[model samples]
Target: MLPEEGVNAVRVVVGLLVRGEYEELETLTEARRLTAAEIAAAVARHGRDLISPPDAAFREVDAVAVPHEPADEHAFHVEFPLWTAQDGLSDLTLGLTVTEVMDGVWTVELDGVHTA
Candidate 1:
């Protein structure tokens, strides 16, 4: 399971994506792993339509631990079920990776909007 901090970070990043706040989203992400342009393109290509609905909401589903080579680092693939009033449950899921930068601090990496 991802820590509460990680989950909260994911929530903020997803909110930014839904709002088309790419510049703000880029600031919360790791530039070494995901570039600004890639972030913008992925959100534009995959997240734009799915998250455009004003009533869309993301509910936490589950998180899977992702192995990392560094002993001090940790990662998890977190998933959230997307829902909107007009469409009910969406086919697309909001997913992202959260990495522990140091101790309890984590950074969000956008996986974009994808079907689970």
Candidate 2:
């Protein structure tokens, strides 16, 4: 798959999580800081359903961009730029995880996040 496709897959995963956790994210303020480390911890405590691949682990990363190599296949890498109005948050990159659970059925998970 093209790198663009991979990025899209990642975006889908992120969208689901955000939509699912919109209420909590919206309540975030400077007083209510939601650091990447904190979020990563939450993913560990409350399953984020972020990823599941052959040998993939359950962990979260703080990132703003999940870089994808230009020459990649089977493992598609795509990027989705996120913008936020909340203070101290300008962007969030959700790493996309695509898996072939069944024939033609694909699963997605936001496994990586860019903080830098």
Per-residue error (Å), model 2, residue 52:
24
Q: After superposition, how far is residue 93 of candidate 1 from its true place, in Å?
A: 1.7
The regions of model 2 sitting more than 4 angstroms off are: 1-11, 22-73, 87-89, 100-103
- Please write out the lDDT profile of model 2 over residues 1-116, one tens digit for every residue: 33334333444445544554533332421213344455556444533344322111122222233243332314333344333334223344444445433444444434445532
**Candidate closest to the true structure, highest lDDT:** 1
Question: Candidate 2, residue 18: CA error in Å?
Answer: 1.8
Q: Distance (Å) between predicted and true CA of 62, model 2?
A: 18
Local accuracy by lDDT, each model = 0.67, 0.39
The residue ranges of model 1 lying beyond 4 angstroms of the native Cα positions read 32-59, 84-86
Highest-TM-score candidate:
1
Tens-place lDDT per residue, model 1, 18-115, is 66677777777755456667766764554335354232232343789998869679999887765544455666676678889798888777776666
